[model samples]
Target: MKEIVIIGAGYGGLRTVELLSGNKSFDITLIDKNPYHYMQTEAYGYIAGRFDMSDIAIDLQGLIHGLGPNVTFIRDEAVQIDETAKVIILKEQRLSFDIAVIAVGAKTNFFSFIEGAREHTNGVKNMQRVFEFRQAFEHRLYAKLQNSQNSLNRAGDLHIAIAGAGLSGVEIAAEMAFTLQRYHKIHSEKSQRLEFSLIDAADTILPGMDPYIIKKTEERLHELGIKIYTKAFIEKIQERSITFKDGTILPFDFIIYTAGVKGADLIHTLDTPKNRQDQIIPDETLRLQGSKDIFCIGDCTEIKDAKKVLLPPTAQVAEKSAAYVARSITRLSEEKSLEPFHANVDGVFVALGGKYALGILFKKIRVKGYFAYLLKKLISRSYRFGLEIKVNAGYKKRHVGSHDTLCR
Candidate 1:
């Protein structure tokens, strides 16, 4: 059997593993620091307390065990990949592989040049961070309510500033606003007590996105009472305040840094050719430049199209790249010529507050309101169903003589 090792259990890594698990000729090992796969796309809802932990985290061990006995799951951090030796250096031991895939994903770009930005603001990159932020946010609201009877000063009690104003930032702000509205109604408190501001260096929110989607999103944000600050370049981020390049200062009780992301730290340490964001520059076939045995996909690699336009590092792109790479690996084993990867973004769905959303399908059709939200939910369920069905099928294949209904 050909030894195959995949690092990172993010969208790209997980999908690739799922695609290749049934191949008996390949022995696959998946390595990641966490044992559960965190559903990052559903983070905003989780942060808003609309979803539970189980809704966003999936047990990797259980999934892997069901995948097949040929697949192994290792819960360890990957420190380096020595391409020359065809070995992966982990914190505990080294792993050798006939084919290796690096899909470690991206990390929050705190813009290290800005003073106190990384130290002061919170991020939702991982489950732990999201949980921490949610807890802190709820606690602050509760504390403010308790002190409302004793103190007249509640100046910045519920002030929230989200830096970035991108998709993540916009979603977070809208969800929080909706949640706060619900809280205000339940407590019979004035809505003025709650304040939210979405800041971005770009001239408009969701810059580079479709104009109609951006316009509708802006309208929704305005309806939610969330403020938008454009072209507000951050000079520094203090614990309770943001200093802008134009010498404008904004104060807040809490801040979320959703500004940007770059390739993970391990990607930066690799000796391979990397872009400005430390993402590997893969060839047309999505393999590491000049290296056929190593394939890099997802947020850890920067892939450009025929027009030289860089693809956005979204989950959709990651999954597409992953599927292509998995097929390419199988083809390589059969001594077939590899095909160039062409990324096509079929659709994008952005969830606003409550059951409201905006979507662009096939890059032409547009959807709005509750229907868009439902479509997004349906799509999420379908993706999860795909993964679950594989697990069930694999389980039946291993234990039973025939494939049968094993899950309700």
Candidate 2:
């Protein structure tokens, strides 16, 4: 049997396994730092307590068991890729592979625009970071309630600034606005007012998305009292304060860097052509530009569109690329030619909190308000369930939340 090793259990790697695991001719081992697969789309929602943490994770072991005996799961982090020997260097051991697929997803990137940003700020990219921010948020607020109930500016009012007006940034800002408002209404005595801001270097938010969608999103953010700062570059992040390029300092209780993302660090170790974002440049067939046997997919690779422009890294892009890569691998075994990976996006969907949302479907249909929110939920559910190719043995739909201390 030929040994096939896949790295990273994000949507891309996970779906690739589902498509190829049924083949008895191949022995597949999936390696990921975490044993569970997380639904990254809902990561921000979980931080805001809109979704359960457990609901967002899928047990990899359980996923493999249902796939068949041909697939295995390894809970380990990938450190390097020794392309010369065709082996993956893990934290503990080196594994050789006849065919290697690198799908290690993106990481939160604080570009050079902000100095000391990643060190001082927080984000909702993963569960751990979200939990940390929630703890710090409540701890700071509770401390104020106990010490300064009579202080000005709502005692411990928080000034939250989300860097970058992308989808994640906008979603986080909107959800926080809703959650903070809800919290104050419940605990009027100990509550603190929250100030929300979305700062971006670009003049427009969600630049590539339809104008109607962007307009609707701006309106919703306004209604939710979220301030928008466009064409403003964050020059520095120092001790709960953000300084713009103009030397204006804005004090914030917490800062989140949704400004950008770069590919997994492992990609830099490979001798492959990469873009500015550290994303491996993949050929039309979804293979690394230099190697035919080594495949790269998901957020880790930059695959351009028909217009020769790089496509955005989204779950849909990852899933579609995964499918194409799997098909290519199968074709390789059969000595058939591989086809190019094409992306066909439905449109953009923005959840603006509190029974409100905005979306553009099929690049034509405009959806907004409560109807858009429901549609977003429906689309999310459909994608999650559709990807579950294996029967989960130990995976339970349990609820693990944040902000428990504040509720008490």
> Which numbered prediction scores highest in lDDT against the true structure?
1
RMSD to the true structure for each prediction, in A, is 3.5, 6.0
lDDT of 2 by residue, 23-88 (tens): 899888899888788888877677676777666777767666667667778888899888778888
Candidate 2 Cα errors over 4 Å, as ranges: 144-153, 189-191, 386-391, 394-408
Clashing pairs in 2: none
Against the reference, the lDDT scores of all candidates come to: 0.88, 0.80
TM per model?
0.94, 0.91
Candidate 2 vs. true structure, TM-score? 0.91
lDDT, model 1:
0.88
lDDT of 1 by residue, 67-165 (tens): 877788898999988888999999999999999999999999999877788899988787898899989978877776776655665434478999998
* Residue range with the least summed lDDT across 10 consecutive positions in model 2: 399-408
